[model samples]
Structures are given as C-alpha cells and as structure tokens.
Target chain A: MKSTTTWINSINNRFWRTIVNSTATGVESVAVFRIIMGIYLLFVTTPTYTWIADLPKALYTPPIISFVNLLASDFPGRNFLVTVDFLMVASIVGIVLGIYSRFATLAFVILKVSVLSFQYSFGKIDHDIMLPATLACMAFSGWGQTLALVPDKRSKWDSPSKSLSVIAVLIGFGYFSAGIEKAIHWLNFDLNSNGTARWFYLGLYNLQRQPILAPALKNAPFWFFKIMDVVGVIFELTPIIAVLISRKAWRIWLFFAAAFHLVNYLLFNINFIGNGLVYIAFINYKPVYRYVANLTKSYIAKALILAAVGYAAVIRGISILTSQNVGIIFIPDNGNANLYCMLIIWALICAALFITIFKTGKQPVHDDLEVVSPQLT
Target chain B: MHSLKFTGILFAIFLIPFVLRLFGLEPYPAILFPSGPETVKQVNGKTEIETKQLFAKKQNGQWALVEPKAFMYPVSAIQLAKLVSKNMGFKKQKPFPLKGKIGIVNYLYRSQNSSSSAAEEAELRNWIKKRLKRGNYQTSEVKVATYSNIISTTNGNILKKELKDEKYYNLD
Candidate 1:
C-alpha cells in the first residue's frame, strides 16, 4: 500500500513538471531565444529572398483548407513578397534589437508562413514548419518582456504562455512521429536481409551535393549506410524519449541532434539551421546570464572571443579584400570561404555555450517575483 | 491552465488513435503525432521507383525532358513559373478506392483516367526497354504498379499514391 502510494505520487510529480515546470522561462532567456530566431530567420530566408521571388504567387493551400479545393490561389503576388521582405527585414531588426519585438515577431510569422505554405502547396512540403509553429506559440507566450529595447513586465503575453511548453512538446512530437513511422516501416520490411537498405535507404545519399563529400558518400560501404539507417531511425525516436524523461536526457539528446544536423549539412545541402536554433526553446537559459557575469570578469573568455572573431571574420575578410581585382585570386571564387565562416560561427557558439556551462551549471536559478493566478501557479 | 488538465486534454487527443492502434485498428485518426505512410510504403515492398530532378525545358510552350547533364542548375524564375503551371495540370488517376457498399457511382466519379495510368505504365516500360536495347540487351517482363505513401505532419499524415515501375532485361 505504501509503495503504491509512492508510485502514484512520483507519477503525479513527473506529470506536473512536464507541463508546468518547463513553462517557467525568464524573459531574458526568452529574448535570447527571440534574437537567435531573428538571426536564423535572416539566414534561412536569404536564399528564398535572393532567388525564389515567385513563391508568393504560387498555388497556396493553408494547412486547414488543404483537404478541399476551395481556394488554391489565395496567396500574395511577387509585389506582396517584395513588400513582405522589406517588412521582414524591419521585423528582424526589431526582434534582434528588442525594439517592439512582439509586434516584429508577429509580422515575421505572418509574412513567412504566407510565403512558405504557398511554395509547398503544389505537392511539396519540407520539414521546416517548426519556424511558423514556434512563432505561433511565441505570439501567444509572454516571451517579449525581456532583453529588448522595450520590455513589458505586465503584458498579457508575460503570463505563462502555452506556447513555451508547446514548443518543447512539438520538438519531441516531431521525433516521435518520425520514429513511429520508421519503426512501422522497418516492421513491414525483410530486416534479416540487406535488400531493404539497398532500395529504400540508399536513395537518401543521392541527395548529397557537397563537392568532395558528395562523391565520397556514394562510395561509402553499404553496411555503413545500413548502420546509419538504423541510427537515423533511433536518433529520430530519441528526442521523444528524452523529452519524456528529465532535462539531462533532453540535453544529452541535443548532442545527437547537433551531430544529425552536422552530418546532413556536410553530406547533403539540406540545411535546417532554423530547427537547430529552435532547440533553445527546450533549454532553460537562466544559466546564460551567470555565464556572462563570470566571463566578463575573466580575461580568458574575452581573449577566446576576440581570437575566434579575428580568425573567423577578420582574417577571412582581409583575405577576400586583398585577393580582389587581381587576375589570380587566392581565395577560391567558388565560395569555399563560407565553409570556414561556418566553422568560425560554430566555434564561437561552442565557446559561448561551454563558458556558460562551466560557470553556472551548478548554480541555482535566482527567482524573480512570479505572479500568476492560482490555476497557473 | 492546470498543467495536469492541459496535458490530459492533449493526451486525450492522441489517446484514442493510440489505443485503437494498440487494439489493431491502424487507420484511427492521428491527432498530435502520426505514424505516416512514408515508412509504411517501404514495408512489404510498396515504394515506387521515381526519377527526381526531372526537369524539362520549355521551348514555345512544349515540355521535353532536359538531356542528362553533369549538374542541375537552379531553375530560373520563368522556368519555375512554367514548372508550377505544369505541375498543377499533371493530375494522375487515383486507384479504385477500398470499397464495398459505396457502389459504381462513387467508383465512376473517383476512378477516371485509369486508362491513362495504364498508358503511363506502358510508357515507363518502353522507356526502360529502349535504354536496355541501346545497351544491346534483350528484355523480358516489366513490372508496373502505383504505390501509396504520405507526407506526415503534427495533426495527421495524409495519404499519397504514386506509380512504381521497372523493366526486366537480358542479364547473362
């Protein structure tokens, strides 16, 4: 009887934490998330902005009306896209600067989703829906109250928004859905034999476009790809399991998630950097301020930041500047420098993260005056 | 606003399908996360062999496959416009729905262009045969069929059917 009561209490505690505990995010953390999102949006939308100008006028079926044939042409034209792009730029600037961040985030969502769904309406949809989904939640969540040019302590958005928890759940849900699909798929195939891997999994590698790695990946051993196939299914299923468990498991899962993105980027050109940045939604950013507080007092963090910045941006920039206007260019015009730029960016990200972890991973969260209704509390 | 209640509601949305699936009703509605058809198609050899990056250049409003090239450049704005227009028009026929009492009227409305689907299968076989003949090989039976799959989402997975085709030729 005592053991049964303990079990029930444990289950209840876990259930409560899963829903409410994850929702307690500080505004500073929310602002950082918003900033990261703003940066990611700029990078993601750049190619579409540069090339696919016709996406706005394409046949669009909103996810709701996708089932029926009511209105496929209820989308904006190129002129609207051009106007949206201007507004998007303005919004990103606002979000990053914390100047009217909420309104900016809302604007970005409307414009981005309008363009994205219309592009995918004609029998194509990529796994980039996290952007709109996350943004939708952000619009509702009171995440706009911190670290911006104009902070709101008492805005309705500051109330515990369902979006904060929803974003975390959705991340796990994506993996679980994929895992369930793949597991069922594996069950339907003759797993004892190698034929399944040859026919189904081999085609995934065919999408690779990396100049060097693309050709190499094609020649990689079939068994390697077979192992990778199994690993992919497992990796896809992991976030769901991790999210169900504790924050430690979720953080550990982020390693695999990062590696997954890295391999995909290196092997194939399918860069979903937006989803990677979205992982911030799952983590508690209370440690970030502590890391910064300790780091500024130390010379090592400052030196590392400067050196990384100088090597990544400055030296690369200098090389590009010096190589210009000459018949023989030292820097490859094929844009190989972008790879080094990526390396630098990742290096800085790692440094920032490591410093934060080292400085404040053990420190307790300093709570502010959190006032919600009894139901929310 | 109660965490338990919120989670309970979300779980309830997904629970019915999950419980039904556990009880062996696989077609139950997927609310939160769907077990999609993309994986299901690969089970029991259902995936179709389809060509991709299959671009056709437009000259005077006619579609012809662009010859095999070392690399595919990004399709231009004008080409993309034409591609979308062309994509919207190419509606292949649906297979006869899994039905019993729905009768011939529903079948007639649903199953148009089935002959074109057969023709498409034949054309795919011929394309394979011609390629094999070019390589100096005799051909045998060619297999052709349409298979089902899906593009999954959070709400549910929508079913999609596409044609899988192959041709057998002299090997020894």
Candidate 2:
C-alpha cells in the first residue's frame, strides 16, 4: 500500500510540474531569440506574396479553414498585398528594436497569415506555419521585458516564462505529426520505396534546375537512401519523447534536427531554416547571451558586426525588390550556392558550441526551473 | 487550478489537431510533408521509377518542354504533376448552415470530379499562355506526359528514359 501511494504521488507531481514549469532560461534568452528571429524574418525569408497575387483568380482554392476566405470577399489585389508586405517589414523592425514588441509580433502574425493563406489558396501548402505560430507565442512571452527601450515593470525578468514551454510542445507535436505521416507511408517491407530517392527523382523531373548534389549522388546505392528514409522517420518521431525525457536529451535532439535540415537542403533543396531557428526556444540561451556580451564589450567591434549584418540585410532586400540575381551567398537559389551557405553556417555553429562548452566550463545550476523531468530537477 | 486548466488547454491544442489528422481530417493547422512515389518497379531486369512532365505547344507547331516550377512559384513539382495527371478541379459549394462563420465557410469548397473543371482548365491555360509568352510563342494547348526513369540495379546510373502516357489540354 505504501509503495503504490508513492508511485501515484510521483505521477501526480510530474503531471502538474510539466504543465506549470517554464522551459526558458530567462527574459534575456527570449530577448535574444526575438532579435535573431526578427532579423531572419526581415532578411532571409522574403515573402513573394506580391508575386503570388498576380496569379489568376480562377486558381484560388481556400485551405481547410474556409473562414479565411470570408476575411476578404474577393482575392486581394497586388497593391493591397504589397502594402501589407511593407507593413509586415515595419512590424518586424519594431520586434527587433523591442519597441511595442508584443503588438509588433501580433501585427506581423496577422499580416503574415493573411498573405500566406492566399498563397496557399492556389493548391500548395508550404510547411512554414511554425514561424507565424512562434511569433504569436512570443507576443505574450514577456521577451521585450529585458531589451526594450520601455520595459514593462510588470514583466518578471528572472522567472522563466511558460511561453517557451508552450512553443516547445507545439514544435514537438508538429514534427511528431510529420513523422507519423512518413511512418504510415514508408514502413512497408518494400526496399524500393525509398522516400529520399523518390524525392530526389521528383526534384530532377520537376525542377527547372537540378539540385546541387544530384549529379554526384544520382547513382548512390539504393540501400543508402533506404537507410536515410528510416533514419529520417526516427528523427521526426522522437522529438516529443525527447521533450518528456530531459533538457539534455532535448538539446541533443536539436543537434540532430539541425543536421537533418542541412541534409534535406543539400539533397532535396528544401529549406527549413525558419523551423530550425525556432528550436532556440528549447535551449538554455543565458550562457550564450553572456558569452556574446563578454565578447562585444567594445562598442567599435559591436558596431562593425551590426553594420555588416545591416548591409547584408539591405543587399538581400534590394535583390528581392529588383528581382536581380545576386551572389549565391545572398540568394542561394541554386544547389552549389546552398551547399556553401550550409557549410559556412555549420562551421559557425560548431565554433560557437566549442567556445561555449570549453570556456564556460559547465552550465551553472538553476534551482527555480525544472529540466522537463522530475529526476533531473 | 488555473495552472492545471492552462496546461490542459495547451495539451488539447497540440493533441487535437494530431488526432484529427490521424483520422484523415485536417480541420486544424499542422505541418505536412509531401509523400514521395509509392514504389519502384523492375522493367526488363532493370530498376525503374516513373514521373510526369508538362509540355506546352508553341506557335511553331511544336510541343516545347514546360518547367512547372517557373510558372508555379511555390507549388512543388510533384504536386503540379499530380494536379496535371489527375486533372483535378475545385467545386465551390453553398455555405452550410452551421453555428459559427468558420464552420459555415469550412464546407464551402472542395476538390471534386476526375474530369477537369473549367477553372482548372483556365488556370492551366493561363500558365501555358504566360510560359509561352516569355519565349515569344503564342499557343493555347498543353500536354502532360509520363516518363519511365530506368536505372541499373547493379550500378546506379540512369540507363534510359522512355516516354509513356500523353494527355493534352486545348484551350481553343
């Protein structure tokens, strides 16, 4: 009787703790995520909704949620969409600057969903839902409490916010759903039903230009792709499990997730950079923020880095507006260019990880927050 | 009690969509990846994969190859191929009498019929017309053709590509 009571109590404790505990490091960590995500939205993801607006109206097919159609009686005109796009940029600037951050995030989400829904109405749905979802969650996360020009006194900077935990759960389930779909299709005993190879062939047949690694890997063994298919499904299905296990497990899962996206980009030319960036919410970003702060003690060095990023963002913005072909690093429309960009990104990530692990020695313990499991806490 | 309620709501938000999707209902927003080809077949003792390509007739009375990616900005090539081969058409239905606006609008439209709808044909014609105009060609007809991508089972080189079924759509 005593042992049974102990087990039940443990379960009860876990259930409540998992629900109530915050997964984030602090307000400063969320602030960093807001700034980085803002820059990514502004520069890397150039919405071609204005171009989409030009497509024939006969092709407009509403998504599963049809009420979106009622938002506008008729399909929006190009000028209207362009205005919305410009306002979206302005909102992103507000988010980055931490000026009325929640309002900016909310505005951005509304405008983004409006445009993306119209784009998807034409019969193709891109898996870019996470970005808007993350923005919505961050709107209420109290991220602006730390870095804002006018920070809210009500915002608790030291206490971990539950918003990150919510975002993590959303991402975990998103990938879990995708994994279930793949498992249903690819788990058959047939060896020839290699999902990766089939996607590669589809890319070759459909794309205007061949994927970068297609020439080299066209003749790769059938077994290799079959292995990749199995591994991909496993990676997708395990995120929720990782989340329930511990924070260390979740971080390790993220490392693999990054590699998965990079490989997918190289082989299939599919970009999931936005979804991958959302993974930052699950990480303990306090150490990373401190490291960056220590390195940028000098104002001149900080200004130089800021200027460079601003310049690149402007160049990317101009290229999108003018529809001109810039260098592969800027646009990365082709495979070779994508490969180089991926390599550079991976290198920088590795360098950051190395510095953080060695220089920081070990992560200091936080007594206030649970590490996704009771045992760890 | 409030914390428990919030946690319960969060769990429902994540799990409800997943459960709906599992039962083949997509009433909620979720991430979906394109499913690849179903199977690889053996033809004449060689491995074979099949895919579809799109072509548009030019003013010179020749069928020129059309890259769907060029005209269909965000649509995947596989999706375009499926759309072309299946000849799918959307049917606009009357809004159902439901309690909420969302529920009413949700049932307002669906894809119906194996045969092409006027809207589908018009959309295709527009794409073909735009593609041809870029190359300074005037044409009103497009073709959806299937090709067998044959590969060596021993070595991975593609041995040959053989064209199979051919379907044409004329806008004139």
RMSD of each: 11.9, 5.4
Per-prediction DockQ comes to: 0.09, 0.30
Clashes in model 2: which pairs? none
lDDT of 2 at A183: 84
Give the range where candidate 2 chain B is weakest over 10 consecutive residues by summed lDDT: B106-115
* Candidate with maximal lDDT: 2
Error of 2 at B112 (Å): 6.0
What is the per-residue lDDT of model 2 for residues A260-366, given as tens digits with 9 covering 90 to 100? 77677667777677776676555556656776556556679667756755665566455446544344424657646556775666544434433433332233344
Off by over 4 Å in 2: A1-23, A69-74, A150-153, A156-161, A188-193, A207-209, A288-339, A346-377, B22-28, B31-46, B58-60, B73-107, B110-124, B153-157, B160-162
- Worst 10-residue lDDT window, candidate 2 chain A: A368-377
Q: Can you tell me the CAPRI class of model 2?
A: acceptable
Clashes of each: 4, 0
TM-scores of the models, in the order given:
0.60, 0.79
lDDT of 1 by residue, B48-140 (tens): 323332222233433333332111122121232223223322335444444434564333333122333444445434543443344333433
Off by over 4 Å in 1: A1-13, A19-25, A47-75, A156-163, A187-208, A282-376, B1-5, B8-172
lDDT per residue as tens, model 2, B110-165: 33212245765677567657655775555666677888878774455668888888
